[model samples]
Target: MRKVIFYILISWWLVACNSSVISPEMVDECPPIYPDYVGVTIPATIAPMNFSCLDGEYERVDVTVTGGKSGEVHVNDKIVLFPQDEWQSLLKENQGDSLMFTVCIKKEGKWKQYRPFPMYVSSYPIDYGVVYRKIAPGFEVYSKMGIYERDLSTFEERPLLENTMVPGMCLNCHAFNKTNPDHMSIHIRGQHGATLMQIEGECELLDTKADSILSACVYPYWHPSGKYIAYSVNNTRQSFHAVKDERVEVLDLASDVVVYHPETHELLLSPLLQKKEVFETFPVFSSDGRKLYFCSAEAKPIPEAYKEIRYNLCSIDFNPEHGTFGDRVDTLIHAAAMKKSISFPRPSYDGKYIMYTLSDYGNFSIWHKEADLWLLNLQDGTKRPIEEVNSEDTESFHNWSSNSRWFVFSSRRGDGLYTRLYLACIDEDGRVSKPFLLPQENPWEYYDRSIYSYNVPEFTNMPVELERRKVERGIVSDKRIQVKVRQ
Candidate 1:
C-alpha cells in the first residue's frame, strides 16, 4: 500500500507541473496593452515594440508570437519583452507576412487566454534613421534641449548638438537636402544666433538676415540641386491662454518667404512673397525645384484678432538657373474659404502628393488641438484628410520617406500633451495605413518617464554626423558671413 501511494503522489506532481505550462481555462477578453499595437502595420526593420499590460490584475503572463513563415517566440513575464536577436530573425524570415500573438495571463491560480491579434509586417523598407529636436513642450522658457538622431533598425539615439554645448542658447529647425545628411542646415537662437549649413561635408555659419529682409531665416527647405535654400523670415509673437485646453498661441506679426543662394551669398526676394497686406511663410521647393509652395494669410490685428487669421495654400514658379520667381502667384487651395488654415506644406519626393496640417485657424497648429493631416492629390487636384493616421488630438510637422512609402509625424496622442513620433506606411494608391508609435525597447516605461517632446520628426537616408565641440566653438565665435540681398 505504501509503495502504491508513493507512485500515485509522484504522478500527481507531474500533472501539476504540466498544468502550469499554458492550459488556459477560459476565453476572456483581449489583454489590455499599452501603445495599442493591435492591427497596426510595422516595417520589418523596426525595433522590437515592447509592451506591458495596463491591467494590474495579472500576476504572470505568457506571450507566444508565431510568425507565418518563421519560428515562434515564447516570452514569460508580466510585461512582454522580446529577445532582440530572435525578434530580428523572426522579422527577417517573415517579411511581407503577419505575426499572430496569443496572450495568456495567470490570475489567482487560474489561467485565461485572450483572443489573438495580428501585426502585419510590410515588405516596404523605411529610412535608415530619423532626426528631430527633443524639447519640453512649453511656452516661452526652455530648459535643456538637443537635436537627436535615432536608428530605426535598432534602439540607438545619439545627440548631434545640445544646449549644454552652448549654454543659454536654443537650437531648432534642422533640415536636410533630399534626405542627405551630408547637406544639412540648423538654426541657433540667443546672443549668438546664426544659420549653420553643412554642404558636401563642410560646415559654415551665416547670418541670413539681410538689410531688406524682415527677420532671419526661420523655416528652411533645401533645393534639390543643392545650390539654394528657401526660407521664411517672420516677425513672430507669442501669447498665453487662461483656459485649460488651450495654453498658448503663436502667430506671425509679419512674415515673408525668400530664397538664399549659398554659392553667390545672395537672397532672392519676390514682390509677391513680401507684401504689406499679406503674410507668406513656410516655403518649400518642389522635388524638381521648378516651383515653390507656401502659406499666405491676410494680415490681421495682433493678438486681439488672432482667431480670425487663416492661411491659404499657394505656389509660384521658380527658375533654378536664374533663381527668379514667376510673374504671378497661383492659389492652390483656398483654405480660408473652407474655414480652415494650412501650414507646413511638404511635397512628397515622388511629386504625387502634398501633405500639410489643417486647423480651424492660425499657422501654429502645434498648439491647436484640432489640427490634423490633410493630403492634396497633385494628379487629380483633390484633397482630403488622412483619417487613418489622425486622432482627435493634435498632429503636426510630418515628413515623407525617400521612397515615399512611409511617413513620420509628431502627434500628441499618447497623453494629450507630449508629442511623440509615429510611423505609417502609404501604398501606391495614396492610402495610409494605421500608424504605430515609434517603437522603443520598453515603450510604456520610456514614454511615461520622458518629459521632452519630439518636434519636427524628419526621415534621413543616413545618420547625421557632426562634431559637437566644433559646432559649439563656431556658434560662440562672432565669425558670421553676412548674406546680401540681390538687387
Candidate 2:
C-alpha cells in the first residue's frame, strides 16, 4: 500500500507541471526583451545572452530556441535563462546559421504566443577575452577600483590588480602591445605611484616622473616592436559646473608628449610635441610602427577658456630604428576647424582605418555627453561618424581586435550613468554593423543591479598571466627604477 501511494504522488506532481503549461492565444505582436538581442549578430563562442521580458503584465514566460540544423532549447520562466550545455550544443551545430525564438507568456489565467524572431550566428570567431577596469563613474573621489579580465567563452573574471592590495592607490591606463599578454603597461596614481611595465613576462617598476617633464605619464601607447612607449604628460585640473546638464570640466593647464625607451631607461623628447603653445596627448603608433599619431590643441586659459579648446588629429614620421621623430607634423584631420575635439586615436592592426572619439571641446571625452566614435580611412583620408555603432549617450574609449574586424567601446546607453561595454563588427569596406551589449548570463539582472562601470575596454588575445602577490609586493616596495631624460 505504501509503494502504491508513492507512485500515485509522483504521477500527480507530473500532471500538475504539465497542466500549468497552457496553449497560447497566438498574438501577432513580438515579445519585448531587454538587451535587444533580436536581429543582432553573435559569435558562436560567446556566452548565452540571457534576457527578461519588458512587459510587466506577464507572470511566467516560456522560450523555445530552435537551431537551423540540430539542437533546440526549451526554457520556462519570466526570464529566458538558457542551459549552458544546450546553448553550446546549439551554437556549435548552427554556425553560420540562425536561431529562431518562440516566446510565449502567461498572463491573467491565459497564455499568449508572440511572433518568432531570429538571431544570426556569425561564422567568424572573436578574441579569447577582454581586460577592463571596474570603477564608479565619479569625480575626484574614487572608493574602490581594479583592473579585471573576462573570458569571452564564459563568465569568469579575475583581477590583475586591485586597490585592496595597497590602499589609497588607483590604477588606470592599462595597455598591451597588439593584444600580446606578455607586454603590458599600467599606471598607479597616489603616494606609491609608478608605471608598472611587463616585458616578455618580466615585470618592472619605473618612475616615469622626471624632473624635466611637467608631470608624470598620463596616457600610454606601446610601439609594435615593444621596444618603446609613447606617453603624454599633462598638468590637469578639474572644476565643477553650475549647470544641470553638465557637471564637471577637466582642463589641461600644460601638456606635452614623449617617447620612452625601456631598454635604455631614456625618454625621447621631441621639440614638435613639447611646444609651449600647444597641448599634446593621446599618442598612438601606426600598425607598422613607422608613424606616430597624437592629438594637439592650442593652449588656452584654464576653466575660463576650456570651451574653446579643441584637438586636431596629427601624425609625424617615426624612425623606429633610431628612435627619432620627423621634422614636420601632418594634420590628418582638422578637428579644430570643425569646432570639435578628438581623443583616443587608435589605428586598426591592419592599417586600413583609425578609430577615435570626437567631442565638442575637451580631451577627457568620458565626461562629455556629445562624444561619439568617428573613423578615418587612412587610404583615402575620408572620415565619417560610425552612426550604426554610436548612441545618444557618451561613447568613449574604444580598442580594435587583433584582426581589426571587431572593436569594443564603452557606452552609458543603459542608465546614462554607469558605462558598459559594447562590441561591433567592421567589414572589409569599413561598414560597421549594429552593436550589441556585452553578454551576461542574466543581462537585465546583472546590469540593473551592478554599480560598477566598465572603463578602458581592451581586447587581449590571451589571458594576462600575472601573480597577484608578487605584483603587490613590487608595488608596495620602495625600489624604483628612475627613467632618464635623453638630452
| TM-score per candidate | 0.95, 0.96
Per-candidate local distance difference test = 0.90, 0.89
For candidate 1, lDDT tens digit of each residue in 179-234?
88888999888888999999987889999888898998978999999999999999
Off by over 4 Å in 2: 1-21
Candidate 1, residue 210: Cα displacement in angstroms equals 1.1
Clashing pairs for predicted structure model 1, backbone only: none
Q: After superposition, how far is residue 229 of candidate 2 from its true place, in Å?
A: 1.5
lDDT (Cα, 0-100) at 152 in candidate 2? 87
At residue 110, give the lDDT of candidate 2.
82
lDDT for 203 in candidate 1 is 89
What TM-score does structure 1 among the candidates reach?
0.95
In candidate 2, residue 390 scores what lDDT? Answer: 88
